[model samples]
Target: MTEPILPRIRPAIAALAPYRQGKQAGPDAFKLSSNENPFDPLPSVAEALQHTTPINRYPDATAGRLRARLGERYGVDADQVHVAAGSVSILHQLILATASVGDEVIYAWRSFEAYPSLPLVAGATGVQVPLTAESRHDLEAMADAVTERTRAIILCTPNNPTGPIITSDEFATFVARVPGDVLIILDEAYAEFVTAPDAVNGLTGRLHEKHPNVVVLRTFSKAYGLAGLRVGYAIGNVAVLNAARATGIPLSVTSAAENAAIASLDAEPELLERVAVIVERRTRLVEGLRAQGWDVPDSQANFVWLPTAERTDEIAAAFGENDLVVRAFPGDGIRISVGEEGSIDRVLEVAAGVR
Candidate 1:
């Protein structure tokens, strides 16, 4: 007989529904579900992986070498870089390090689905600021929602589902208005794909210089095409990053992942060329969708978003029936990744018929 397994765990832990990843974007399936890079890892990255020694040994617990390389690339100190299994792990660590029971965590709803859940996992309260009518984050409303208990806030720029970005000036103003101690996470997973002149590259400039409380999260998953390798890092003030590091699980990042990330940085020129293609494809996808009478928003990321929740299921089913899987959020909208040349055409055709 099973002794009450349900009652033995922490209520917060018991209440969590496990995180769900996007559907597999298989080659045969015209997959556009996850917003993964359409290209493969760089040749240098592949070469580095072949020489990765003894998988039997534990990975560098501090991710020291990777941190140094990242520091060099971003112009931040090695002490400020904290590598994790992926940006998702870094995001989770940020929440767990700051928020605790009854404290509030704020972010835009429908931005990153994990944003609200991460706080809940830490036994913290969540505040979801509603998006504007245009499906962009209402930064002013988020600012208004803050209180003494609000410990952290997440800002996913060129935001995940909406694909719209808050300009550098707007972000600067927003950051200025927030309390100094509140941890602000600028998750820039798609930063490499952005072409907007005003778009803030958090690590490359002013945000890092001016805001001590702000941390930028980046990944090799999107533009660098290293999603399967699971390497990412956070850039911030050394003290805050140190705190996050102290709270993070040691040796969670693999040596293979570290090696791949370092190689990706070294191979930036080629990677950026691939990124340019994705940007062009994104423009094509958006314009094509709009020409077909779809209400798509201005996107700065690797994906485009539909504006109405009502059309989400229909659009998804249309693609799925044609062996194209896409991410759909109920009462939110549909999100389709801009994939290879032919895949976008499939998405457009299915989208054209969704009605």
Candidate 2:
């Protein structure tokens, strides 16, 4: 018999590994593998849930009211906002809308794992630019890598594996080099957790004003404590937003998710207060790790990156032994999310033992 054929599957899918989201391993485990908010959803969000009774019906297909609220909050019109199940959903849609077979999607290696996977799923080639030893994106190198075959670029600031962000000036210079037609998806999944004064706030108003190709992706998954809700949105020119929206899966956003996100927005001030605390503790974690002989990079996100080329497995094992489950990429070092202060201290203790 001949082999069964599934034409819809891209050839690249065979080689691509699926994204592995962090999960709770044991009942007593301090699971800091995923970068999620340590706190629960805000009281305002709970109240919104109480008042929301629309679960029996389908949510507003366009998410009009939430889009309007996002517009008012971000200084853009509702047309410029594209909401989806989560930022990853927005990213997947962006790749689907822009790329085709043989096209290239460029991003920093050791950044977000999803960046590489999205391109392959779009039937496009993935171009992974390696991050520097210091764990920052080499924007100049990335800009030079763009060719006529390139369709899009995914720039993750406060980048995933390594947590530093691209500065505003650096982004401006980088954007100038890329051709105007190439789509740029700036993933700011950890924007709310970033304390750097110069952090590029994801091409929202500024980048959109200058370049029609730029789109900023954000989510309520991290700082808002709504990872379970799976809500994210993109801010860009209306045409680009519409193009991305066109590729979305059917009825992706639920009424509960929409209500939760809107509630998150209403409680932004209180949420920001928690962000401030995490920032302070993140600094302490970095300093303590560095002091203990760990080659930890300065992180802008709510996580710490340890640069271990060979000892990645051993370090991850040690953490697991201590009931602290950190995330481990193949060649990259371990990434531990900044949970509660005590949880971070436990990770530091595990690090101390590893050192």
Candidate number with greatest lDDT: 2
Off by over 4 Å in 1: 1-7, 25-27
Estimate TM-scores for all models. 0.96, 0.95
Model 1 scores worst on lDDT over the 10 consecutive residues at 4-13
Q: How high is the CA lDDT of each candidate model?
A: 0.86, 0.87
Kindly report which residue pairs in candidate 2 clash with one another: none
Residue-level lDDT of model 1, residues 106-219, one tens digit each, is: 999778878878888888999999888877778899999999999999999889988988788888888888999999999999999888999878977647668899999998
> After best superposition, candidate 2 residue 330: deviation in angstroms?
2.5
What lDDT would candidate 2 get against the real structure?
A: 0.87
State residue 278's C-alpha deviation in candidate 1, in Å: 0.7
Single out the weakest 10-residue window by summed lDDT for candidate 2: 201-210
Per-residue lDDT value at 189 in model 1: 93
